[model samples]
Target: MILCVRFLLDARGEALLPDLLGLLGELTPVVEAAPPDTALADVRGALRYFGRDAEQLAALVRVRALALHGVDCVIGAGPNPMLARMAAREAEPGVTRVVPGSADGIREFLDRKPVVALEGVGRSMARTLCTYGLDSVDRVAAAPLGTLQRILGAKAGREVYDKARGVDRGTVVRNAAARSIAAERPFSRDELDPSRHRRALLSLTEELGVRMRGSGQVCRSLALTVRYADRTGHTTLTRSRTLREPTAHSASLTEVAYAMYEALGLQRARVRAFALRAEGLGPAEQAARQLTFDPADDKARRLEAAADKARARFGERVVVPGALAA
Candidate 1:
């Protein structure tokens, strides 16, 4: 069984993600880290060792996280990664939501869900699907494959059709996300200005790019965590995305971080801090670069290299982007 765990951590507490991954490691070796506050654990093997089912193990893991780190988490249990991830979103903090590992059970759980609730269904596609009356998972699943393909290209349609039916073939990849570098920017005070938040994100990506380039590494994914300024209780929203390819480019990193921040949909919420993590590091020499035809894209890469050298000789402040300049 797959257990998707999302740690409810504040910006400052994102540094604890690795330790939380370790806590899961004690239960199973197939724990996949999806930082800045999530992980997937294939606990099928650990069930017999611990003498508990997936749901029981999830509860134990939650209690252990709170007892050991004072971190509350929600867990989603399913037969595969996709189902588990979807289940996690439906779960509240400090609880476990399960998608039963049976064909009938999976269908019953997913059928009534909104089509937009499926991961990777963009806003545009959701509208398009809804136009055709495929507003729910069951409706999408019931639609003919050829019809969906005509609406949303062949590849995406096939993928969506399979997902709506709770058919996920992905496995828990045992890559070490512990080999990551993180950068955090805390507001001098809780700030509400969107422009300032973006500036901080840009500054952070700049730092991450310089650090990764200096270390001769490239990251395959990035994570962004936002902390709210509520003193009574710390509230954090985190989201991570895998890049199409490995890169240490500052602009690319900045773009992904901005998208993540926007996706959180926190309009005018009191923001206290932001945390970014670059994960799945590999030697820069081993990474492939996608060729681009645009001169601007080429120039940006050239300028990035030059900026890295300037920062190495001078200082980070010496090579700040125009947007980051006060």
Candidate 2:
């Protein structure tokens, strides 16, 4: 059985997590708390006790969250986790979205959404698709897989193709833990210098790496998002060759982050702001390190270690990147 559930809380502060988790406990024992104001729950077992099917059970959860806890949430129901998450976002506040878990149902649900609405298709890729006259998710799904791969990279193209067909195999893992730390800054003004943007990206990546080592977590993937002056944004995904050894090494993360920024080819483009999100987080004990013979890599890492110590003793603003200085 496949059931995807989400609770959009009315509250926004730290209390949101505990309150949402409390409400999930009333419906099922298997609940995973997503940060800020979202959560996922497995309700296969709750169906019998609630005397309703999956859709009915989802409605009950939403109603109780509203009537009892005074939280208004938009709930999405699907046969799998991806569809439910997407559906939930499709609805406005205080509504329920249900995607019938059937082939016909999947087609109908995706028929009207833009290609960019699919989870992995970012603005650049979607624009490339639009050039080909494929504006909707249905058009992209109907196009050949090879066609998509040609427009995007092989891995990203395949992922988008699968999502368009409603073929997501990911499950709602209960008690899922976070493995990396990240922060993003939205610029108040648009800038065109690649060097300045790189500085901001490096700062965020270094901050994330410091937090990772302090909390004993290592990151494997680094995701970057760039918002353009026009309000459209693009996301770039890249991975480290080996698992990051948790050591609060800002330089190590900075190198990887800079490489990703260069790959975006942002020369002469007006960029609003940049975000660096570290992924593939895991316990320090579970991470494996690779032997690097590059002297530059080692030197950078050593410098990063010293910088982290200074930041800890002082303040984050003490080591601000030049471009970020007002």
Candidate 3:
């Protein structure tokens, strides 16, 4: 069986994930890193050596993580990765949630959830599904796969169909190297101003973009994490968007970052911290750059190159965006 553990880590606590991952490694060799605080482990082989069932083993791992690194986590175990992830999402933090290996049990567990709660279903897809009255997992499962295909594309239709049925073939892939860059800014006090939030996000994207470009890497996805006030129980909201293509440009990163921020519509949220991550990284040389005819776009690229040159020679702060210049 596979187990997915979602770690509850604060902004300062993120540094402990690597230590926690190492602690998990003591239990099984199949620990797969899920970035921004999560991991998947295949414990089938360790069951005999540990002399425990999946739930019990998950408890032991959870205790070890807490005892060793003061990291409390929620663990969900199931027959497959999708079920495991969904189980974790359903459970409360700092607990072990298990989905039975039986088909009937899986269906019961998944059937009542809102379609939006499903792992792969986004806002747009959920709205589309709801329009057809497939607003719940059971409804989605009952619909013919062809209907989903007509609404979505063939690949997405097949994927969601299998997910609705709690069938996933994915496994814990071990020894994968992280290929993303991240930056975080914690406010001295909880911030409510939307302008400040935008500035922070822009700064983070600019910082991450510079690092990616410096390393000759391009990212195909952007992730935003908003940490709320401690008074609200240290809640953190995270979202990710896949770009149209890989890019190491600040403009591309800024556009996607702003889009995600605006979607949150947090007019007066008492946000304590902001984090931005660039993901799905590849060599810059490997990414195909599309030709642009707009003079403004051409001018921006040229200025970006010059700014990089200035930063390389003078310092990172040599070419700051006007919004960031106090």
Return the top candidate by TM-score: 3
Candidate 1 error regions (>4 Å): 176-182, 190-203, 214-326
In the range 160-270, model 3's lDDT, one tens digit per residue, is 898899988788888665567678988998899999999999899899889888889999999999988656476888999999889989998999999998898775888
lDDT of 1 by residue, 1-326 (tens): 89999999964566798799999999999988886678999999998998999889998899998999889999999999999999999999766899999999999989889998887898899999999999999999999999999999999999889989999878999965446888999988888999989998898898889989999999999989898876677698889999989999988998999988888887587888888899888899999999889999899999999988888889878878888776
lDDT of each: 0.89, 0.71, 0.87
Alpha carbon deviation, residue 120, candidate 1 (Å): 2.4
Q: Write the per-residue lDDT of candidate 2 for residues 96-162, one digit (tens) a residue.
A: 6778878999999998799889887789888998999888989988989998888887988889889
Q: What pairs collide in candidate 1?
A: none
- RMSD in Å for candidate 3, one decimal? 4.3
The deviation in Å at residue 184 for candidate 1 is 1.9
User: What is the overall TM-score of model 1 with all chains considered together?
Assistant: 0.72
Give the 10-residue window scoring lowest on summed lDDT in candidate 3: 8-17
Most lDDT-accurate candidate? 1
Model 3 alpha-carbon miss at residue 258, Å: 6.3
Go through the candidates in order and give the C-alpha RMSD of each one to the true structure.
Answer: 5.8, 7.6, 4.3
